[model samples]
Target: MTTLAPASAKPTPSAPTAPTLEWVNKLVSFDTTSRNSNRPMIQAMADELAARGLSPVVLPNPEGTKANLFATIPARDGSVTGGIMLAGHTDVVPVDGQDWASEPFSPEIREGKLYGRGTTDMKAFSGAVLGVLPEFLSRPLLEPLHLAWTYDEEVGCHGAVALVRELDAWGIRPRLCFVGEPTSMRAVSAHKSSQLYRVTVSGLAAHSSMTPAGVNAIEYAARSIAFIRSLADDYRISGPFDESFVVPYTTANVGVVSGGAAVNTVAEKCEFEFEFRTIPCDDPKSFISRIEDQIAILRAEMQLENAAADICMTPLGAVPGLSPQGTRAALELAQALTGNDAEETVVYATEAGIFQRAGIDAVVCGPGSMEQGHTANEYIELTQIAACEEFLHNLAVHLSTTERNEQR
Candidate 1:
C-alpha cells in the first residue's frame, strides 16, 4: 500500500477546480438508480473524460443496460503497473416510497449541505475525483492512478464481481484501492458481510371448505420464518461477538413476504426474501446451509400433506466482509489521509470488501455520514467535501516520484 504526505497546496490556475457540490449536483440529476439503466450517466462521465484526452474503458453488463468504467492516469514512464485505485459505484438506491422535503434527484444546497439522492451515499466522492482529474494528468507520477466506477452496488454488489474480474484479467495489479464510501472522512477498516436470499414455496390449491385437500403455503412459510427468528435468537445468545460493530453478533430477518391471492381460497404459493449480516469470523454460507436444512425439513413435511408441494431457495446477492487484521499498510495510509488516529468498523457494507477479497488492500474513507445515505433528502456537508478534496491532493502528491521511493 502507498502512504501519502499531508495534502499539498491548492491547485494552480491551469489545474481544474477542486471538486465541489456543483459536480455532485450534476451527478444526482442523472437518476442512476440501481433499478434503472446507468448508461446515460456512464456515457456522460465517459464523454467528459474523453474530452480531456483520457480514454475510459466501458464494460457493460450482460444486458447492456449498465456498465463499469475503468481508466488510468499513466505513470511518468508510461507503465500501467502498481498504482492506487480510486473506486466507486455509479448507481444509487431508489426513492420510490421515501418521504422527501424536495425532489430527490434534483440536488439542492441548504445551510452548506448538498441534498440529493447520492450526495452522501456517494457521488460526492466521485465528484471530488473528477474535480482533480486534470491536475492528476498534468503531473508526472511515479506510479499510475486509476479511477474505477462500477454499477449495481445498491443491488448487492453485483456489478463489482465483473468489475473485479476484469481488473484481475488486466494483468496490471494495483498496489491498493480506496473505496469512497461515506465515513465522514474517517477511515473504516472493517464491515460485516451481507447475504440475501429469496425462498419460494409451492403447494396444492383448493377451496377453503376442503381444508385437507389443499396445502396452505403461507402456513408453512410462517414455520420457516419462525425458524429464521430462532436462528437470530441463537446468534444473539451465542459466544461469537466482535465488539467493534454496533451489532456485535450476526443478525437475520425476513424483509419481504407475500402469498395468498384471496382471503377465502387456500394459498397455492408463497415467497419471502431474507438477509443476514455476519461478522468477519463467521461464514455467511454456514447460515445459508442451516436454512437449507430447515427448508429440507419443510419440504418433507409438505410432501406428506401434498405430493406436489415443493420449496426452493435462491441466492440473491452477497458481499464479503473486510477485516483489518492483515491490512496494516492500508489502514495506516487511510488514517494518514484522514488524520484520524483510530480506525473504525461500520455496519453498512461497501465495495471495500469485494476489493479486499480480490487481494487489493482496500480502505473506506470518504465524505459525509452513513446516516444520510439511502434516506429521503440525503445530504453531504460542504466541509466533508472540502476534506475529500484535500485527501485527493495528498493522494496526488503521494503518487508522485518525488516522495521516498519504495517498491510496492
Candidate 2:
C-alpha cells in the first residue's frame, strides 16, 4: 500500500508567487476607497521602489492623510529627463451598496478573472509597471522610465492637480505619459471634460401653512434644475457633435438635491449638485457663466419676495478634456507598442486630460474594460494582464533600441 500524507499535513505553503499578481493582491487588500486615506498604499509602493535602488518622491496632501508617488529608473548614464511616464491612481470607488461574491478588498480569482474593487479600475496596470521594474532596470536605456501613482482620481481628479503642479515645478517633464485607465490595452486619444458644481439656495423658514410668508427654497431649486435640463436638451439637438464619443455632444444632469426640514415647514436652505460633461469644443467656464446668468435672475426674483433671500454657486472641480490633435506622439507610441492600428475616444473623464493640460502628451491604454469598473464583482481577465506585460516588455525593447541607436 502506498503511504499517504496525514489529512492535516499540508504541502509546505507555496511561497508567494506572481510578482504582478502579488502586487495586485496586496494592493487590493487595502481599502483605499476614495473617502479613505491612501497613505498606506503609497508607503508600501515607496518601500518597494526604494528596495529597487530608486528614490521615490512622495507629495502629501495638506492633511498628510493622502499622497502621490513619483519614481524613476534613470538612463544608463543616470540622467532623469525627457522619458516616458506610466500613471495610475491608487484610489478606488466605494463598495458600500454593491453586492459581491467575495470581499471587494480581499482579491479572489475565478474563471481566470481577478475580482477586486480596483483590479479593473486601475491597480492591475500599476502592478504591471512594478512587476516589470526589474526588466526596466536591467536594460541600458536612452531615456528614463517614470512611474506616477496618484490618489483620489475617482473624486474628480483632485490629487492629480497638485501632483502635476509639483512635477512641473520639479522640471522633470516626461516626453509622453500613458494613463492606464481600463481601455483593454487600446490607445484612447481623447475623452470629454467633467465639470461639477453645487448650488445652495437660501430662504426664510416658516410653517408650510404660511406659504406666502416664507420663500420656498425647494420650489426655486426645482426651477433651476429644470433650466439645467433644458440646456442639456439643447445640446442633444445641437450641431457641435463629435461622432467619436457615445454622447456626441455636451450633457448636463442634476445629481443631488437636499432641502426642507419637515413637511410642515418651508425649507430655509436648499443645496443641489450638478455636472456638465462638455465636449472638446465647449468651454466649461462658459457653462458656469450661463448658470451664473440664470442664478442672477433667480436672485433678483427672490429679492423682490424677500430682500434677505439669496443663492450661492461654488465650483467643485473642473478637469479639461484631452484633444486628439495635440496627442499625436502619444498616440503613435502607444499604437506602436500595442501593435494597434486604430484609435478611440471615450465619454468618461480621466486624469489624462489633466496631464495634457500640464503639457505632457497622454494616452489611455491599460488592461480590463471600463464597463467592468465600478461594478459589482469588478474583475480583470488574466489574458489582459498577460497582454499588459507584453506591452511593458515592448516598451523596454523600444527604449533599448533608442539607446542603442544613440550609442552608435
Candidate 3:
C-alpha cells in the first residue's frame, strides 16, 4: 500500500531538514500524472512561494487545467540584470500499468530511501528548492535567483515552452539555468532530443476475397514502418559517436500500431506513432522528411490502384537536443556547491534543452538516479537529499559572498 505523508505535518528542522524530501513527499501524495490535471499541486507551490514572500507568476494553459509557476528573488541592489534560473517540472508520468510494492502516490521511507512516484524523476529537486527557501530568503543576493516549475513535461516539453515564451514577452532573460533532473548529483551538459510523429493511413475496406480491389492500409503502414526500421539501422551505423550516451547515436522506433476490425475484413485504417531521439548535431527534420518522402512515394503508388488511398503524418512534439557548451560555469558552481564531480550525459529528454535554446547556458544537475525515475517503487536515497541540502547551503553562501563583493 502507498504511504502518504501527512500534508498538515510541519517539518522538523532537527530531523536533518531534507526540504527537498519533504517537498517531494508532499508532491507525490497528489496524483499529478501526465494524463491527470496538475493544477492543485501548482497552486500549492504558488501558495508556498507567496508565504515565503516571493510573488509567483502562474502561467496557465488555455484550458486552465494546468499551469507553470515562475518566481524571482530580486538582487538586493535592485539591478535588472539577468540572473540564474532553477527549473523543474510539476507533472510526472503515469503509474497505471506499473506494478509496485507500495502505492505509487503515497511516499514511503524505508532504509534511507524514499519511494513514490516522481521521487526521482523530479519532484525531489523542486521540493529541495522549496525546502531551502528559508535559507535563500535569508541571504542578501547579488544576482537574482529564479524558480520555474512547469507542468506536462511527461507529455512533451510543452509547459516550459509556454513559460519561456512568457519570459520572452516580459523581456526577462536569465544568464544561466540549472534543470534539477535526476542526475545522481552529477552535472549533465547534453542530452538527445525527441521528435514524435503519428502517421495515419486511410484506405477502402472490402472483403478479404476482394483485397486486391481495395488498398490495404495496414500493408501500407507496414511498408512505412519497415522504411523507418531501415533508417534506424543506418543511423546506428553512422553513429553520433558520443561515449557519454548509452546508444551513442540517433535512434528511431515505431512504438504503437493499430488497425483492422476482423480477420476476414480488409482493414480500412492504420495508425502508428513513431519517435526519434536525435543527437544534438543531427537535424530531426531531415529524418522526418525522409519518412514523409517515402510515404509520398508509397501514396502515389497506392493511388494508381485506388484514388481514395491516402497517408498523412502529423507531428506530436519535438524537443531540441542540448549541445555541449565548453566548460560550463554554471556546472562548475553546482559541482563546487554539491562537492561531487560525477558529470555525465543522458539519453532521456528534459526541459534543459529548452533553457539552453533560450540562450541561457543550462546544465542538468540534481539529486537521485535516473534508474529509479518513472519506475515501480520509484525512489531517491535519503543521502541524496542530505547532499542536496549541503548543495543549497553552498549556493546560499555563494550568494552572500557575491553580494558582499558587489557591495565593495
Candidate 4:
C-alpha cells in the first residue's frame, strides 16, 4: 500500500489533452485495494478536479480508512434541476496471492494494450472519465455533470453506500447515472445482485476415541453445506433471467471454509462463507431465511445431544440487482452514442443497481473486456479505448442536441 502525494498543480500545457493513458498509468501505480485505504487516490482525484475549478467533497468512512470523492460541474444557468452522474470506484481487488507477469502495481503496455491490476476491473474507466474532463469542461453543458468515485467496491458494494448516503444528505439527485464498468463498450442494462453470508457452527470437542461424548462441529457444518448446495440447485432451477448472461440464471457457491485443529480430536468450531447472485425478481433475504430455518433445526438436533451446540449466521454483504425498468433512457442514450442497435445483460454485478435504486436511471458501458479483469497481465485493447473516446464525443453531441431541442 503506497500512498502518493496529490499533485498540487494542473496538467502542463504540453501534456496530452486526453487523460486516458496517462491517468490510467498513474492510477495503476497506487495499490488501492479494499483492505488498504484509498485516501491517496481520492486525494489525487480531488486535486485534479480542483485544478479544473471544481471543488470536490471527500466523504470518508467513520474510521477515515477509505473515502468517496464527489464533484459537480454546475450548469451555467445555476439551476440544480437535473444532471448526469459519472460513477466509478477507486478501490481495486487484492492481487496479493495472484501471480503476475510484471509488477501488479506497475503498468505495462504491450500489443497496444495496457496491463495492470486494475486495468479493466474499473480504474481504466475512472481514468477514461478523468481523461475526458477537458472535453467535458470545454462544452457549455446545459445540465450539471456529477463525478462520483467510490471505494471498497471490490470487497462488497460497501463504499458506494456511503456515497449514496452523502448524496441523500446533500439532496442532490441526478436524473441519470453511468457506472463505467468494463463492458467492451457495449450497453449493459441489467445485472444480478450478490448476497454473501458467513455461517459459524460450534460444538464440544473431545478425544476421537470418545466420539459419542463430543459433538462433531465439522460434521454439522457438512450437513449445513449440503443444504446450502441443495438451495443453490433450487435457485438454478427456479431463477429467472435473460439468456444473454453466461449462466443465464441465479448462482450460489461456497467460497471459503475453515475449521478443526488436530486429527485425533473432535472439531470444536467450523465456519464457512457462501455467496449467491440472484436475479432482481428474487429476494436476497429469502436465501438467508431458508438457511437459517434449516440451521435452527440442525441446532435443535445437536442440542439434544449437547446443550453447548450452537450455530450462527450473519450477512457479510449485499448488492441489489438492477433489472431493466421498462425502457431505460440511459441505455437508449448509450446505444445512440455508441451507434449500437443491440444491447445485452451481464451476470456480473456493478454499482448501477445502487444508482438505479436511488431513482437515478443507470446503464453500464465502458471499454475493455470483463475476461481480462482480475487476471494475470490484464489489459484493455487500444481499439476499445478508441471506441470509448468516440462514444464520449458522441455523448457530448447528444447533449448539445438535447439543449438545442429544449431551446426550440
Candidate with the greatest lDDT versus the true structure: 2
Worst 10 residues of 1 by lDDT: 11-20
Q: lDDT tens string, model 2, 319-339?
A: 889889773777877887787
Q: How would the candidate models be sorted by TM-score, starting from the highest?
A: 1, 2, 3, 4
Clashing pairs in 2: none
Backbone clash pairs in model 4 (N, Cα, C under 3 Å; residues 3+ apart or in different chains), count = 1
* 170-254: candidate 4 lDDT, tens digit per residue: 8999877888899987889989998888999999899999989888899999999999999988867776655767787778899
Per residue, candidate 3 scores C-alpha lDDT tens digits across 273-345 of 9999998778888888898899999999889879989999998888898878653766666665565656678
Candidates 1 and 3 compared: the better one by TM-score is: 1
lDDT per model vs. reference: 0.86, 0.87, 0.83, 0.81
RMSD of 2: 8.9
Clashing residue pairs in all predictions, respectively, total 0, 0, 2, 1
TM-score of each: 0.95, 0.94, 0.93, 0.92
Determine the backbone clash count of candidate 2.
0
Worst 10 residues of 2 by lDDT: 1-10
lDDT of 3 at 400: 63
